[model samples]
Target chain A: MAGGQERILRRRIKSVQATRKITKAMELIAASQIARSQARIAANRPYREGMQRIIREAASADPAAARKMLATPEKVDVAIVLVIVGDRGLSGPYNSSALRAGDRLVHMLQHQGTRVRLFTVGKKAPAFFRFRGLDVEQSFTGFADRPTFADARAVAAALAAPFVAGEVQQVLLVSTRFVSAGSQVVESEQLLPLVMPNDMEVAAPTGLKGYTEFEPEVEQLLTELAPRALESEIFSALLEGAASFHTSQQRAMAAATDNADELGQTLSRIMNRARQDSITTEIMEIVGGAEALRSGK
Target chain B: MASLRVEIVTPESALWTGDATGLMARSSEGQFTILPQHTATVGDVVPGVVRVATSSGEVAFCVHGGYFQVGPGEEPGVTRATVLAGIAERVGDIDVARASRAKETLEAQLASPGDLDDLSRAQLTGALARAELRLRAAQH
Candidate 1:
């Protein structure tokens, strides 16, 4: 019995060590992915900033005309909520947090007597909402970890059609915002009706910002620019979501690895104590048999 | 000075930045040239080659539809020209054979008698135009 118990303890230790190895590798992979995603986000910044500047210049060319297109309708009969989450989630609270925020937003919009249409990006959000008995109108997947501009365009196209068709009065986007390497927050922001970039979002270009000669009219220019701006915004958000996912994954994996280490240590200690107890029992048995022989003699 | 500060930027990187005597591009309205102190102009650039004439020499870029902006610079007479392209390739960097092949394939696809939806048709047209532009720039 003692030998059997020792063998079992040894196997358990081996299994724990194997699990620790996997966790350690996962932690490393997540760490490297975080770095790569962060670099991609940085590289994407220039184009996004440039696009914003152009849009701002055009929009300000004639604020009145731009406002006609940009204004959010007062009465929103139906709103579309786009929730972006990760496709594969082991990433801590990244997917769950975004889904929770989206859920709340949907509930709030419904409370206001607005019909909500749900569009989800990433594999997780659709199933999550469906599990909760909510219908997902559209779901896009397969590019959550590394989204391309084409992906953004596809998503924008979906969002644009409803707005253009006068079906969706408002469009809201929920995703994990990658503010910095150290911090990320799940938040929802309005996507449609083209918000004018405030001073905070973009630096006010100096001197004759819209001295631009519009090819046609400012209104036409704005009409053309809106979809491009939407694509850029979505692309940026996707990049941010990828970065945040990696960051959260790295942290979570690191914790798991650490926990595995602690558990392994505790198991080893327990196994050692068990072995010692088994050895003591064997020694006691041997001593009792010897005393029995002595008394019999 | 006739020289203008010309800059071409794509989503990936800044392709070119130099002082050029003139810059030429095509828009929906038609082809236009920009010289120093050209009225702060903004227009849409079509898929084509953007020619920049600099003191050093002439440089061309195959730009896939984007926005072009020109405004006054810090100097008294200098002007800044910014070309923001969705994708841009320097003339030297363009792969001529590949571009020609792409152009041919796109042309074939366009020629095929099929009922393509509006979006795919538009996408194919854009791709064909971009390929043709790249091929032209490469040949030039």
Candidate 2:
């Protein structure tokens, strides 16, 4: 019976080891992706900063025109919520955290008597939301791991249509912001009625403010610049989301590998003790048999 | 002494950046050139070739519709010119064969009798324009 128990333990240990191998491999792959995604984020910094600077310049030139676009709407009749998440699982809380935040935002908007429309970026989101009785208006898949500018452009175009058509007054985005390699947080922010960069974050104007000349005038330039700026924002968000996903997945897989190792150690210890007990029982029986033969003689 | 620093950047990466004598491109208003100590200007750059004149020679870039900003650099006597395009690449790096292929494909798509949404039609037209510009820039 003990031997049978030992056999079962051995089989379990082997299975654990096989799982460990998978987790270890996943950890290494995720680690490699982290560096690459970080590099992409670095590469995009120049364009993002440049776009922000141009926006600030245009906003300052004609405050009145900028106010119309930058000001938050007083009452939002219909709002679109966009959630960005990773397409794959095993990334720890990276996908769920953003999804939960988006869900909560929709609930809050609805509580205020505003209509809510949901849009998702990852394949993992639609199923999660649909199960909760929420209807997904649109879902874009297959690009969460590595997003291109064209992908961002498509997303922006879709989000902008409703806002431009006066059908939706507000657009909100929920995604993970890659603050640093060590830290990431899920945040929700307004995407439409463009949020103007605060004075603190924006670098001071090079020289005299309002001295910058606009080719087609500030009003026309701001109108044309809105969609492009949206694309830039969305692209940067996708990049950061990717980096955060890789980092989260690496941490999760490393933990899993450690857990597997501990489980294997505990099981082997139990198995070894079972073998010793069986050997002790056999030795006792042999001595008893020898004693009985001597007494009979 | 006054100097000019030019940076052509896209969403993916910075295409090029260096000290340059002048930057030339066409905007909605007209063609314009920025030299050292140029005034602060912010405007749109139509899809075309953006040329930068360095000491060695002129380098050309095929920039899709984008924006540019000319402003004072961090240091005094340095004017910084930045071009931010959604898509852009060095003219010399453009693959002429690929551009021509894309042009042909887009032309066929547009000419087909199949119904296309307004958004898709606009996107196809934009792609065709970009491919044609790339071909033209490579030729020059």
lDDT, model 1, position A278 = 90
Give the Å shift of residue A158 in candidate 1: 1.3
Question: Best candidate per DockQ, number?
Answer: 2
Tens digits of per-residue lDDT for model 1, A1-297 = 767877888898899889889878988998989989988888777678777767777766676776756677899899999999999877899999999999999999999999999999999988899998889999999999988878988999999998988888888899999999899998888889877667522433552454568786777878888888888888889999999998998888888889888988988888888899999998999999999999999
**Model 1, residue B35: displacement in angstroms?**
3.9
Candidate 2 TM-score for chain A: 0.95
Model 1 chain A: ten consecutive residues of lowest lDDT: A200-209
Model 1 C-alpha lDDT per residue in residues B73-100, reported as the tens digit of each score: 7687888888887778888898888888
For model 1, the stretches where C-alpha displacement exceeds 4 angstroms are A199-210, B1-5, B17-21, B72-78, B107-116
Q: Model 2 residue B37 lDDT?
A: 91
What residue pairs are clashing in model 2?
none
